[model samples]
Target: MEIRWVEAFIAVAEELHFGRAATRLRLAQSPLSQTIRKLEKELGVRLFDRNTRSVALTPAGQAFLPHAHRVFEELELGRQSTRAAAGEVYGTVSIGFSGALNHLTLPPLTRAVRQRYPQVTLSLAVRVVTRDGIEQLEQGSLDIALVGLPIAPSSVRTRLIGREPLGAALPVDHPLSGESAVDLADLAEDGFITAPAESGSSLQESTLRACVKAGFQPRVVQEIADPYMILTLVSAGVGVALMPSNVAGIMPSASVFVPLRDEPTFMDHALAWRPDNPSPVLHAVLEVAEEVLPTPRT
Candidate 1:
């Protein structure tokens, strides 16, 4: 009947050992066993088959497990919805972003949040790598981040926004500029620029893997921290660079954009927040991002 009894029943059922469940729940075994007894008494059924050496769930307990899980899930959802309606908008949310994300996703995300929750001040922290974003999130400095996946932490709560296939950008005068797409192997001898590995970007690692998959190690002509600088260098004919398809719209120039053939891979972009401290503006941001970008580029 009570939430604590439900919790106690669920815990013991999961552990299948009263003492172990009590230890896991941080309570004395005697109290836990008594709580389970009370739960069984209230339900008017034996929920467990217990002896000195073993414990097993009764048929009724097995039947009730799914219902208990659903109850907890619904309770949490109700709490979040209630908090959302109350305009819990005074918390400071620190947000981090990769460079190219500003052009592809930030505009719509910002507009929606500003319109919906003006009181929740967002502190923008732009960084070049996904690891930087993850570190900030773990340190409690960042409440949210728009990160390129393959770099985000598994522990963080993430919602996918979009993905863009890797594309080649070269100056109009470059030898391969006339083609609509190029094979990664063909650019083996060409000078390449990418985000440096030291920046802790998984995109940087993916680039390397892409080249390796194409049976070559890219000739590193330069390592630039910002996506804009890489585009600038490519435009200057200093070298070629691999960029997300969405970045092409922002880097409008004489650079010819072509999708990679062998490594037709994409960088996944997502909005991440700490699971424990959910951001108040996140739902609005997700709505805007979904509306603006329902699907990734082909």
Candidate 2:
């Protein structure tokens, strides 16, 4: 019933390959498949058929594709009328965002924009990394990006949105996990898991720097990009991690997040955009973003 479901169906119908469709849509393949499954459940029809090598749309999908296109057209027409009535900014603003921003930031900002500018569509891409975001913004593929700070220098302009406290992620069975808070120095003997170093991932540096400030260089056991997967590894008792505290509850059952006890480390988060890019809709969205999630000066 949702437009996103229809959009997913259309993407798969056109691409006929889930991997390529997910790439085109800027989504992970698994979640993209889940969306298709949800749509099939809603409509009570299989949209695609495949067996390891190929995908073909079902009769229902071929029939549904054009109607899905019409659905967007009709919505745009309605939005045009609404924009004319309200004199609101009208265009699409594509965004690239990742990490804790997904959980703590996007919804309220998207909702506020929907109320303020009915004609403006916010195209949000998830699972984007800091490295990809920086390149994408410079390449003009993204109007804005919400990313962790201390990123590689680019001409892109940024405004600090918030600061997040860093903490240790440990297996629930670990001795330190029982504490209300654990001192960073106390984890010197534990092996660590961290973000990819080549990606200019802020989390990687945060983990290393925080550990250094607490007096020991961490022994990194693994490098992974996905935060949830990182937590998965932690839950499996691989190693401890220093991640933003907001990510605490993601694998809470097996992994316990213990706040860093002394002079906790903080990571900066910001919204980045190219100054030369001129998009009124992008500017409007930025304005709304500032109003809704103002830069937390600290």
Which prediction has the highest TM-score against the true structure? 2
Candidate 2 segments exceeding 4 Å error: 1-86
Best by lDDT: 2
Spell out the clash pairs found in candidate 2.
none
Model 1 lDDT, residue 78, Cα: 67
What digit string (tens of lDDT, one per residue) describes model 1 on residues 81-166? 57678855443456788766457677777766777667656678876367877777777678778877765336777767787778
**Per-residue lDDT over 1-298 for candidate 2, one digit per residue giving the tens place of the 0 to 100 score:** 7888888888888999999999999999999999999999998999898779999988988888888988875686577556656766797888887755356777778999999988788898876777788899998789888888887778998888879899989998999899999899999999899888886677888888888899999998988887778888999999988888778766656889888887978988788899877566777788999998899979
Error of 1 at 282 (Å): 5.2
- Cand. 2 TM to true fold: 0.70
TM-score of candidate 1 relative to the true fold:
0.65
For candidate 1, the per-residue lDDT at 249 reads: 70
